[model samples]
Target chain A: MPSSCDEKIPRIEHHQNNSDVSITICGYWSLNSRERLRLLRRWESLVLQWKDVLRFEIKCDESLVWDSSLVVFLRNANRDLSVNGGQVVFLDLPAGLNKLLNLADEGQKRNKEQKQDPPSDGFLSMEALLKPLDFLGALVISFLNLVRGRSVMRWRDFFASARNCSASALPIVTLISFLTGVTMAFVGSVQLEKFNATIYVADLVSLAMVREMGALMVAIIMAGRTGAAFAAELGNMNLNEEIDSLETFGICSVSFLVLPRTLALFVMTPLLTIYADIVGILGGLLVGTLVMGFSALHYLEQTQSALTDMWEVYSGVSKSLFFGLIIGFVGCYKGVFSGRDSASLGKSVTSAVVISVTLIIIADAFFETAFSLLELR
Target chain B: MNVSGRDDIVIRVESLDLAYGNHLVLKNISFEVRRGDCLVVMGGSGCGKSTLLKSMVGLLAPLRGKIIIDRDELWLNGDKKRKETLKKLGVLFQNGALWSSMTVFENVAMPLEIFTDLGVKEVENLVDYKLALVGLAGAGNFYPSELSGGMRKRAGLARAMAMDPEILFLDEPSAGLDPITSKRLDDLINELKESLGISFVVVTHELASIFDIADDSIFLDSESKEILAHGNPKDLLKENTLTKVRSFLERKTVNNS
Candidate 1:
């Protein structure tokens, strides 16, 4: 019995002889991508009809000129038939086409074998839980080696990183810090204006800038800029096998790549934080004099009085040092351990920024609570 | 510059000089690739083999030379004409250079999409054909990261061949591959050359691959910063050529024996 399907180019003719089923593929059989999708959908329905047939034979017309689309269609059909306890055989194909089909089959088998053994879930695996501890252990060992002057921490790398972390970062830090201060002053003035306490807006802005906002904003900015740069650079080096080459040369990659970057950030961050605090106070002064209708002398006097206690400025600067360490460590960690591919490099850069920002916030919260308990607030 | 009778010459380099920021890499290099010829570029590491291939493919600018392709001066022409000339060529980078963000199908379809006005369906069909030709028939949906080294190289080759270019340039195709996979790649190159009449410029130091596929060959010496020898690999192995070339080929043979 012959049944003709609606597919014009790759028309499938189904025939049944007792318990045996034979499907003949006739016509051009060559289809573009959209047509291939439609053909696959049609073939899926046809396979459902042949579920009860134990034996299946597929024949391709000699006029057929096809490509991988045909292979995909056949592979899907074969898989469907096998699942339903049917055996399918291909016939009348060119030798090259047959070889291609066999190669595809081998690839599919290898993929299946790989898929059969899935990786353990991150939350469920003990190894995953210990990964952070392992990273910390390595960091400590590398740090100790550096302290002993036995590490391959080059002064040139440190100076270069210092320039990258400080000089290259100044413009963005200034812009962010200034804007943050302006926002704080504007928002605080609106509330203070109702009580005719707009003059106190200077106090609010100065206190926040010197205690939290300046360092926090700078840390977040660096996490996005410098931290991501580190990850991308190191991840690319890792992909190029430069890190492996370093190992072959008896050089410690961690000490050579990480220590300099972290130390540079550690030294530059607090200096930048102090600069950001001054820039932020100046921005608050701008809003007080121009937007809030306060005299410049009065705003400056209020800011000076509010920031008379140097402990607030010191706290923010100290927090930035830790934030810098977190950014550098996370960036270098993600990069050095990155998988050997461009996709992994992109992923490492994204996670470095994300993890650094998150850890900065957490560390800031701890600092805030500790300062509050000690009455430094 | 006469194009009256030399219809078979696909590419000609005259006194090519290449440099990177004042450091001369290859100098006074000249060669010609005839239609359907498989020309192997052999050299030791840092010997400017890749640099010469890059210049030939228009990825780099030679310091001074005339690179004539399909009877058109490659470097002398403006951007539009240069692009038109480049359309007739395909270069597969050493590391496969498959875009990590896209699947194998998308990577192969990129050239067809950019260069041709084919509808999406037609592009898909042609991409499938190219992938099948490179023996990656069912690996279309897989990303480059998921593929093994040999599979990635095949995918790269499929992408390079997507436009059905007349001249194909492969940089170290068999590097980092096992002997069996290398042989298979060599066989595929020869098959494509014979079937499609595509001229190939392959840069490789693998002696086995050079003997298996090269119809003609050129040797670039790093220390001398020039082409030391140019001829058929089998003939060069027997003939009294440059000492470097003789030792380079014989050392591999000696190691194998």
Candidate 2:
């Protein structure tokens, strides 16, 4: 920085052989005073040397203009010098700097008065465990209130979200299911053609699509699509205080906003799953007939024989009902409790989809095990 | 609404007409708000007081005619010149409209930080002083949602005064407060008018606030779609012969004696 240290803008001197030990500062000081690295080192060592000399006097220059940087330096110096319950009483050093320091102290006092430290996000924390339970309890009460005609629920939101998730989502869901069926059929034919059992490809693709793939695919699609949408919409509404104005009008935001979104997902998820199942079976039929040179009627007959009853399709459709509920509940939960910022809202949407997908897979596995245990398969 | 053509007039609306789509709200409206005047724009609900206020503040362009704020035409001036002219105004919305994410200190300091190159110490001092002026000295750390309704208004007022604008436009400052809180806010407005000597154009229908703070006022009529009365509101209440003006000013609530 400066060309030389001869600019004694800041010179911390250790006074000795005096009635009172005094640390004296002289010359014009400012933020430029910080550029004196040599003086800073000398000041630190002097502080270390005079740790016991807690009572000292502060001397100032007559022609010095300073800012908060000086106040910050002195406060830090005070903290270092008076480590053992000694008072660093600041006498007069211009009224504005004193007022700034006093305002800083008042800010600290106000923060102390509002003792709202954010709760820890550890999994074992009691509050974290209880939060979901509390949200569910409120949601249940709000639902009851709605059923009893005591609360306002936006039916338009329900219809709008239902239309969005079901109709608008068909294109991607169809493409994914069609590709999955084609892949399954193509792979099954490779193994079966070697043993001259190529016709069984029809059985393989139909059974997988109806029993396992259909509901799972639809649930994952909805989790990423509709569930993430729910989280973002509610999170924005929460940030803008639209939800708060609802509360001030004595209307429950859960009933007014969340209930409609959740209900839309619940009603639409199963319908989309059924449509996906049919489209997937059509995909398999196309591959079995066109690629394998089998007649469409024969492939249909083989699929019918593979599924002798409605039991397999019923099982997948029933699983989709709970899948719908999981997606709806998780999405709204993430949204309704989202933090108050754009970044946090983005995280809420991501976590809504992630958590819903994970839960859907876990629930599907449990359903598979339950069906096996009951010998329903 | 226009009467005198004195040089002290800070804002002059000349033959201004405002409209939304096909419906014209105010036609051939002319007004002059003199310097250091607390001019309350009062009317019944949906009389377009807010629309008139908005037109003057450069948010809405006039369908026709001109709005001059301190000799700078709002619509006729080019973008760069208009922006400089707009810095002379500060506005408070119907709600506090404080940014939800920022603390009260950040909210009040935002204008200073953006428009000026003052140091952190000065910005902090100015923000603290503005908050103190609004009686929210210790509320710098709280968010808008954490504040009560009255405190939210005061914080918004503090932020409005951040740049020391020549005119402050307040839309329904007493819209959501209790009677006592609204009265205290009226008193604070009066004190600011006396202390800072800044012009205020307040859009409200609150009778208590109008009587407490307005030095001059305009009453916009919905049916006629014009400013029917202008002058000191207290004087208009006693002497104005129009039933429309008398009925509005002398109207009493059943809960009061």
Candidate 3:
């Protein structure tokens, strides 16, 4: 006494009408006609034991629903029959025909209404404003949560994150920092040699490296390279619902994912700044001794004396720390707040890098202003 | 056999309305799930099945109405209350959303590490036990990408079961799987439901999986965007108010064969 009421059409018979198309569904039913009607109303599609046929009753507003030339598509491995209703169509089936008819009525009503009121705005424009707001709110919450959750350091996780962010970043950071050093020395040599202050080039390079230039250069570089990457990786994961899945498993998405990367960048950024400082100074020294005709010893002597202040060193380190926080927070924020799709991830990552780098530069300007006003440098 | 009764009611979602702009995804949807009961939500794509699941979990807030879990009204907002509600449930996503970077052991152990005061050894043992429960004992060291589709699903199941939640939500757990594999996963779901004594609300359009495991189910009509019928799957197929449900069930049986 299975309750399925199935109607079967012979496989060999294809119903044809003068102008209207015939749709046949083959199946079997155990119920009586009245019960069959109830069951068919409940289930729009039928299940048959052997191959069966079903014929569709078609009507249309445009008279195209009854077109005999319409294509019949077999889907789901010949289990589904799809009829395309070109302009307008209403098909009488077991259950859904009534609903379709109602929809058609509704459409007709809307069409009439649209004609009456032509100035009506479509719904899509509202969505445009709301989506970015949604994204921004999620981003702010994600960033604040990460900050409040734990310490900005997780040693093991930092090591793992650093391997991802810093280790691969070494060659590029080194190259840029090296070039900065060479450029500084070359620029300084031209001016110093005129005053017979050729040896003072070391002093120029040292002062800039220790006080502001080294950290600024490295921070900007990391923001472009690693900050964007963090966003792309984490944002892609978020889009995939991976972060939500973690939450469902009773895992904190912020602690498990965000903390490690933030802590890693916090540690790595300073080390990278220090590395940049060394490379830049050496480049300056290379240009001074080789290109500017100053002795290596003379350049070394000036750098040693001019850059020995602890406060100068501290300033460079402190700026790196602040820069790291900015990049990490912005990158992780973008990642966790990414919408649930690939296109959203791409946009988030792009914004993460652009916003982070811009913020870092602004903060650097603030640093310059503070140091100058306070006479700390 | 342990069966669910009235007192076993776990989650009750009442008069839920969910919308994004003017597009109403779920309209006044209401349903109840009891402890030790398997409630399946069967619907086509864009029929608001997943949206309903998300609302119940408090991941997506309903535009109107309430969700009560174990007779307690779970807050859809407020940080403290949300965390408390979250602890009572576990979810397995459609794609097995395992963190690709972490090994299976880490993925399963994540919850234990986060919410518990357990020591390292105890956490490890707990993780291993959960993985073993899902029949993935020695595969703990493998990353998610290394596992096959079925194996990844199993790992996700293990992770979901790691916390021994009072309620479980699975989104399309058998999607994209072969019939045999899908059946195997459904069998695992059934075993977990019986053994854990936890309520399960699974969102799926896979009729075979639903019929095999569902104790009670709801069918969503795509065109009308409403609950066409709700009851035991077997009974619904027999005496549904909507022709769509009967047709869908019949189609399911034919295709599975």
Deviation in Å, model 2, residue A6 alpha carbon: 6.9
Model 1 over residues B13-127: C-alpha lDDT tens digits?
9999998756778999999998999999998888999889878877678899889988888888865477678778877777787756469998788666645689999998998
Model 3 TM: 0.75
Residue lDDT tens for model 3, B1-257: 33444456788888878865456777777888867889999976778888888777767767888888776777555755776777888888888888877899988887777677899999999988888888899999999989988888889888887778888889999998999989999998899888878779999988789889999999886556678889999998888755567778877421211
How is the predicted docking of candidate 3 categorized under the CAPRI scheme? Answer: incorrect
Number of the top-ranking candidate, with lDDT as the measure: 1
- Number of the candidate with higher DockQ, 2 or 3: 3
Query: What would the per-residue lDDT of candidate 2 be over residues A1-377, giving only the tens digit for each residue?
Result: 22223464655554654334665555545666555556677778776766566476665544445665677777787778678544455545677767887676666554432434454578678867898888878778878987897656656667887899899999999999898889899999999999999999988988898888999999999999989988987887677644543332224667767787777877888888888888888898889989899999999999999989789988988999989989988998898789879999999999999999999999999999999999998
DockQ (Cα-based) for each candidate: 0.02, 0.02, 0.20
Residue range A225-327, candidate 1, lDDT tens digits: 8899899988887785445433322245677788889888889888999999999988988999999888999999988898888898899999999999999
Checking candidate 1 for backbone clashes, the offending pairs are none
